[model samples]
Target: MGLFEDLSRFLETRLDEFLKANPHLELWGLEDQLRGQEQDAIRLLGDLKRREKQLEDSILATAQDIQRWHSRIQQAQAANRIDLVKAAQEREATLLRQGNQYWGQLKGVKDQIMQTRTLQKDIHDRRRELKAKIAETQAQRTAQRTTTSWDTGWAKTSFDGFGRDPMDPLEESFQRWETEQELEELKRTMGK
Candidate 1:
């Protein structure tokens, strides 16, 4: 599998590009790209898991073989068969060597598993962060557009040639207070 850093950086760049394009698009394309990368990471993780399991089984089998060989050696020694004992000893040594080889392979597999897990975590985190950023940007853009539209609508609604409406003083005062309170609440909620 490719490096997680490289994959995340590539996705980040893609997201940046998508943001720089037409902002009105649905963002499904970028979402699809992220999904594909996530799938690839998952597949690689699955493969590593399988390889780890295979190595574990191999180590167990080798250990069982070593135990059997030790038993054979003990039996030969008890039977006063020196030649058979020596043969069993040699076979035990060979099995020990093979066991060591499997152990080394298992260590390598374990290291690979750790590396892949780290990569998987990093990729998952980056994907979440990127999606959050996209969502934030989209929300900001939507809010700005809504504000602009509302401003235009309000300006169009309450407009006279020269001066403003001074007729309903009580209603005007209440509306003004309500608008002020709403604006203050919005600002507070947005931490602005």
Candidate 2:
């Protein structure tokens, strides 16, 4: 059909062949790899969260420092200390710049956290899908085998004790005698 469908079919065929050849081991290995990827993504998300918190703390501290400097500048101006006011203003400006940088970095870290989470989710979904596919394929193979065996009646049929003629003369005579004895017994019971 379409190119994507063709590619998908090709990949699925190869995957089936690989699975048939290695079965549980290959599937387990792939699942383990996906799990490892998920773990790594989670760890990275943790690190990003930690960095975001640190950045937030740094920004808060900077804001506090800026407020304190503003109050000091007011006090300096009230006391007519222009020199101290100017110095405080410069310090406040620097803190503001540093705070902005931290904010930018925090945003970047948050974006990375989102990306890592998405990657983890994808890995988890892929792992689940692969497991389902493996199980379905295994079940189909088992059912196919069962149908084949049952259709052939391998277990229900046997050639044991068979001969050219299944009914020998003496065996036929014996069967007839047994039938007659059963009939006589049934008749006697009815009479009683």
Candidate 3:
């Protein structure tokens, strides 16, 4: 068990380092976790509903038995049979206690279902937020076309790789302006 714990801790440390290095992948990881939580909450909600139904049935059965015994107690009273009346009253009280226990269990299951539903809703919201962040990350990566030196295309217009004019003045002006815009965008992203 000690060795297994060591291995688990080692793996968790490695995973954390990996996520820190690739921050964009962290969004995907969080979304995946939320999806699993959503599924788990849904499954648990189903189980709780089934249990609630069973408890309701038990309470109903016990209530009916309690009522039947109550009738017997009244009948014994009218017949002046004190012994039977006493026994029927005891049986009715026992059934009432059982019914109350079932009611308590039913209330607990209902509370769990409510909590699980809230958890499911929270996970769903987190997933939506993470998906939006992932989409923004993908768009940012796509927009960052140049990896070096901020892409000053003015030099390119004056001299191509072979020291010849690459394009006319009109085109050169447009390319230089476009390159500056891209550089500014990259700077803003880096600041964040």
Candidate 4:
């Protein structure tokens, strides 16, 4: 390889090693973002539930008012008081209109609550998937580190009961020669 290509490879290897030694550095921002999203989902769900309850209560009270006015109109008609009956009928009509409006609003609020709940569930599921992916990545990294350490341990062990150094000089020299030969072969193949 050219000098610049070799330098690039060296830099990349060093960066990988640095990052492997500091696993938390890469995950910090992503973890924080996930936490924030989870919190926002929880807050939104709570707000939607509260609003749904309020709308339901308001709809119930309006329905009760409409019923009360209807009974008053009936009582006035039974007493044969035309003036009182007419006033009660008018009041009942107004209350009926208000009740219909409140019912429509309640339906709209219920739809919104259902939508919000669905969104919350989606966010919750995504957060769980993200957490699982992060855990899987961590487990893979740990396995890779363990394999590397196992290889290093083998390097330190004696081969065939020989009290030689961790790295055999002859093997190192042969490896270097092989690497140079491979590079030369690559260069020749590329017509460099």
- Candidate achieving the largest TM-score: 3
Clash count (model 1, backbone only): 0
Structural similarity to truth (TM-score) of each candidate: 0.57, 0.63, 0.69, 0.57
- Global lDDT scores for all candidate models: 0.77, 0.84, 0.86, 0.76
Candidate 1 wrongly placed segments (more than 4 Å): 1-19, 23-31, 147-192
Model 4, poorest ten-residue lDDT window?
A: 153-162
lDDT of 2 by residue, 136-160 (tens): 8678877877787567543333333
Candidate whose lDDT is highest: 3
Q: After the best TM-score superposition of candidate 1, give how far the Cα of residue 40 lies from its true spot, in angstroms.
A: 2.6
- RMSD (Cα, Å) for all candidates, in order, is 15.2, 12.5, 13.4, 15.3
Worst 10 residues of 3 by lDDT: 148-157
Q: What is the lDDT of residue 82 in candidate 1?
A: 93
Q: What is the lDDT, from 0 to 100, of the residue 108 in candidate 2?
A: 93
For every model shown, the clashing-pair count is 0, 0, 0, 0
Query: Which prediction has more favorable TM-score, 3 or 4?
Result: 3
